[model samples]
Target chain A: MEKKYEFLEHTADAKFRAYGKNLQEAFANAAIAMTNIMFDTEKIKPLLNRAVDIKGDDLKSLLVNFLSEFVYLLDAEGFILGRIASLTINKTSQGYRLAAIAKGDKYSDKYETMGDVKAVTYAEMEIREEDKGKCWVQVVVDI
Target chain B: MPKRTELLKELFEEVPSGVGKGGITKLTKEELLDLLEKGSEWSLENGYGTKADLEATEESGRMKQADSRQVSERALARGKPQLGTLGAGNHFLEIQRIDEIYDEEAAGVLGLEKGKITVMIHCGSRGLGHQIASDYIEKMEKKYGYSHLPDRELVNAPLDSELGQQYFKAMCAGMNYAFANRQMIVHWVRESFRKVMGTSEGMSQVYDVCHNIAKIENHKVDGEPKKLCVHRKGATRAFGPGHEEMPEKYRKIGQPVLIPGSMGTASYVLLGTRKAEELSFSSSAHGAGRALSRAAAIRQFRGEQVARELMAQGIEVKAASWKGIAEEAVPSYKDIDEVINTTVKSGIGKAVARLKPIGVVKG
Candidate 1:
């Protein structure tokens, strides 16, 4: 089976490339990759769900806002991401909007912590459908 | 020996550290706003630290320009829950023993005695500051698209413009949040000492400085005094002696510059020099800057093996997870002694004392 994401080299932060057959799947996998950086997402049981609704000026901006939402959720409310059940990106007259339903549990001792993703950056962010029906997203996050 | 281990455990527990660990203080949205305005002065009023602590902190623990009203609701929410936390990722609470004193006069003035223990806490505004930076960065990018810029991260507004002023105010608020956060952690460290060694007295604060932030300051350019907005990103203040803004007690010795090494390495204290202001805008290296990526660190070192080696050297390490240990291996960073030596050789900084970590609590 092909991997969902792979960690990349970064001098002082975490960088990764998430892959999927489509943009939505690629984004969902990106969330998982970022959460896995904080803790093992496989150990997170989907005890609750959160509806993430955010908008941005463009696709790249949308990507940063989308990933940063998870950082905010974990810090503001003790919620960690286990999986992304659904995600959709829409192009509006102005820019874009993203809606996602993320399933996860309240943080607990059962989950092992590696580190926290503090913020998402545009340093080396990319959104591309390189091959036909093949999508990949690259992100550099400040840890 | 037991006391050392107990101190680490107690600190690790009292001051929450690691991923998913919330702050110890639970503040309402209103209280969070107040904190953003007052900074460490808020900590003093709330019975956490002392007035002297505020005196020793960068910007006196409060940025005068900070207006909490400029802070966004999202930033407020993110900062409210984690008021006193040492967030994960290179943030740490270390108990170090001062081992070498290079400048006896400066060390004596700073009260850094050889072989005495000192605590060092490295962290920032947590989610609040992060959210603030992201929020404004997005705001800037939205107003002015990054297509023409060198990098999207460079999307910025003119400092005199409304959007830029708003960001400056919000950034100051976030800086205040970081100040209060460190003050609260200092209280917890004192409590840990009391719980473990039965005495919390005589733990006078040395000094605290802010890096990775911007400041509006007065500097001399070509022998003329000018006010400049100094952005010390990934650099710390090394203010020279007799700066009017510094605390009076050490006005003759200069401000203390803290440069932390990587885990399991020697950290240094250097006196800020007038040459620093003239040569480098009074800024010094923040830490032993990362030389290797974290992914490489993890692939090359196991957490257990790393901990075992540090333990073999008589250093006690306690962390939220083994992954944290592996990711912050000492080899992953450049040599601190070399960095400080370069700073000293540049005449912008003078070595005061060298500190070796005896215990660490990773957040």
Candidate 2:
């Protein structure tokens, strides 16, 4: 198993650096980092799934929208995420389109929800392939 | 006030069940749309609280600028369900005891006294507000391309631009949602008190203030009054005595600024000072302010241990998650007393009353 993401220190909110072999993996890992912040991911079961489709004018915006959909599901539907089944990203003429199958379950009494995330802020949002064959994305969420 | 144990039990039992769900109170699309438009006015008209409560709220519980049409469909979808919820992370509803009075006259005006019990509700517009911000951030970044900006988070549109005005209207709707959300919680609290104590006496609101907001107000700049868009993030509006917006009863003393502290810590009630209007734009610190990240706090303390410590101090703790408790340990936050001292020393606000929590319910 590969390391997905790592949490960082922020004065007023939660921050994380997610890693992947490529952009799709990086976005999926970012979702994991965010959900893991709320509770122990091991306790969650991938019993249910949802489709995520987001459009952005650029790669950065694409990542923000992708993560934003998870935040929305959690708040609106009480859906807590477990794992990412698959993700596909394509560059379109206008911008970008990301389609993903997110696996998770409805938040239930059995799980201890650590925190509620407000938004995936653009504060420190950035993507880089600092090392060969690896990509890194940084994001700070307003809790 | 009822006995501490009884009060705490009532609060613990009465808080709406489940963390994220909107509780038993269901709202149709039309009703939620109305709430986004009217804010606390909807709550008042729906009989959630009294008009006096609105008078005590910032903007009188309604932002006339709020245009529900400006809110995006995605934002509305996220907000429609979470309308009356106690959001997770740091948000809470606490029953506290007024332990000290710094300004006797000011405290009297705000209905504060030593040993008086009070309820403090803290929450926001929930997913609706979050989605609106997410939607606009991408919009602004796409339109302006903020690569030159120091941080992408600083991406913004000119306040007078069409996109800027649209975001403003949507943000105002979000603010209104928060105002109405808090108002609904207040109603549930009164009912909770009545259920446990057989009466809702002493549950009257002292004041309700919004910390995160942008306001259009008149302020003197260079000896001339100018209308400015004042944005207070992580800060509260502390309008001093005689401000035209303050309630008639508070105009003589000053607007009430409720500075809540982390669980198991002391909270303060401060009154706006004349100095604030001159120096800090009539704004004061919102909380003790998070000094430690949640991850660091979790590593340093156990949630159960923190809960035990608070219980030993006679503060009852009820939360949906223990990890949530560990993440909000007292050591994770700056000292309330010290923060309040800074506010007083800077003359941004004057201390009026101090509160110690007896009961706390966190999401």
Candidate 3:
């Protein structure tokens, strides 16, 4: 799927703008924008592979747990994910379960820390899929 | 947003708030200065806490470069007697339980075994910090002309300017005051728990951080590393592993980022990432941003109802007023999970554990 992305400044923080034909593609693009904030996306290579699974009751919570788990993989295991191989998400009795495979490099000095995001906040968050197969989400990253 | 009227009502009744609602103890300027210079150390010296508590605090609960003289008399006066007090509006002291552990290793380091009780304090320099910001922002607005600036709220003064330095010093002093305030309150909280449970040995500082103010930091912007006076009004620093600022024990695990939710919701403890510096100057979200305005919140919910609901959920709440409780109701704020997700996706912080509130005290 083809996608477009941009970074928008809201208040003291920034939010990623993603446009795609499906929810998965939009999420993938948003993830790319998030990583691109740290390093040049083109410079990262898929050198190692890993899988992640997250569960939440709602779409918002599912998205948060998914991203949080992904970042944990990179920080704890030194894995810089370059690609989302596959993702499967479904509702469960508890909330939602998401399983994903990602591939990327170990580390690179070429990247820089932009701002210290303390954690994801539950403020001014939204995810919408347009009628024309376009999807977008706005999240406020704590910095 | 929680109904502002309801929150105000509950807050006014239960929590000791306002400009001059003194706590059980008061402090003098000299004592306040000591708190500013020493941070939690002074509180410990005064028998508020022990040495082990300091290890869990960020920067050992003190910013070394803070110059107290830069603090104005006005700021000092505001801080005096305000030390050891919890200020109003979103600032709180919550007794929470480690409801879930995502990373056992990090959770172990934080001294969290499932069901363990922890006290989370959410506050800043109180009136002193607010006064400093008010004074400086006024000066900067006059000098820079707010309408002409890129962002009206981004009024700034040069880092080396007299006013700038003074604000920094005063802000640091306020930070110290907050640290001392939390420390003193931690002592009281222990006392309170001891009175109820007949034990005081288990409580300890997991982490303490500031959500507002600015600091001079070294970061690589572009390709060269440079010093910049980073202003984090509603943000918290999330320094990655191996940074000099981190405690030696936490260096390998990254700095602890405490994100407290509203009265009955779940809070989070996250860790910093090296990738954070590139994403946000090594900063992250402070809390669940207000989804509803205070006024709107007060109009929508009743403090008594909110309190009752929370109590039914097994959460004990104490507030200065019922209206205040309404203003801080869970529905008044955004979903915390979303905020955490953005940070993780942005590669700024990683979640270590989720905390569920058991008891709360609001100012």
Candidate 4:
């Protein structure tokens, strides 16, 4: 029930900082922060669960690919995200891989749609771990 | 005369201006690839616009280097259903009238007459292009690694390297998709006018050019001519007069650069200047950038208030939701008049005419 994310001031795009007790929570919060830019996450009823498995060159790549999956779903399949049901990040022999299930409903007129998020950029992106084991992920999206 | 509100509603419904997916048409993967390869020609062949429209388009709406094979399956999937959709964000469709003409000859050549209505559509490759950039960033980082990069987003492959060429080709295809997307919308705009105003005649395209694109073009560097891959990121290519790459009619006047403003503001049409070649690789600022974030805009103003204010000013605006209107409020952007004046004074472009929005449809 702690603070998950807060919006940051940006000139042209949407910027946010998400927090979690650990990396999994931070990554999950980051995904929610992104979807919140377009629609209200609370309003999205979890009508379906999507399986996500993706590999990246490193932790940063893993985080990006992890979040980008939701963009694809919204655009290609009209899936509106509610929350990250479960997530795990594993260190692979090559690099990092992410597996998770995203819970959301198919997009419909019931949702209050705003601007579209074009893509997630690595611009000013940060992943930090602080004392007491709190992890924070900062992201800037091209809307 | 048909009511402006009626036409605005028709355009809003016809253009699919929302975050929801699926455009006016759905394409199979193979058919989508062909559209990417052919660009606006595919749109025209399908009877979207006239032959004159293609001639007025930059590169005639096709990039020869584009190969759909270079595009990833993921990009294709996202792009296939979005060919004719007007996407959300700063993208828009406006019915504007020539409010001011600074250069008489230039305005005459480009067919800008006082009080004449013109349709301006501002958009890009949508989800397809977004995935292409994401895919290449992941692919390039694996090969080149981002340990030394000042910005991870700047991670790039060598221009002549295999990976670089592959991304270049794929990016070109994305540009093609945008060209075709706008062309199809042009068709819809014509159709909307015919349905509402009862005549689609004299609705001809003036010019269409890419806002952000990296191209291998011949330019002088340090006083010596060289072929450079000029990446005009967040800029519009403002090639000067006599540039052979421009349309035959435009070669005498230079390319027509279209700059769309935020909701309830004025857009501008500028002619390319020769000095731009020497100043900054023949590029000009694309639009009046955001002065405030979407969150701040929403927190400060409601969409209903924004719509009502514009309506009071005799400008009719339509969008999917009130939240959409607030995010694009006119006060949330920098002074567009100042931006246009800066471009003209900097000598990169010449002010041809200023356009005032009479009706707008936002995504």
iRMS of each prediction in angstroms? Answer: 1.0, 1.6, 19.4, 1.2
Q: Is candidate 2 or candidate 4 better by TM-score?
A: 4
Question: What lDDT score is found at residue B64 in candidate 3?
Answer: 74
Model 2 ranges with Cα > 4 A deviation: A130-132, B1-13, B17-19
- Cα lDDT for residue B40, model 3? 90
Model 1 C-alpha lDDT per residue in residues B310-359, reported as the tens digit of each score: 99887888998888899999999998889988999989889999999999
lDDT of 3 by residue, B189-270 (tens): 6666555556668676777776676777899989799988887866899999889977777888898998877788999999
Best by DockQ: 1
Deviation from native of the Cα of residue A40 in model 3, angstroms: 56
Question: RMSD for each model, in Å, please?
Answer: 1.2, 1.8, 21.2, 1.3
In model 2, how large is the Cα lDDT of residue A69? Answer: 82
Model 1 RMSD to the real structure? Answer: 1.2
Query: Best to worst by lDDT, what's the order?
Result: 4, 1, 2, 3
* Better model by DockQ: candidate 3 vs candidate 4: 4
lDDT of each: 0.88, 0.85, 0.70, 0.89
DockQ of 1: 0.82
Q: Regarding TM-score, does 1 or 3 come out ahead?
A: 1
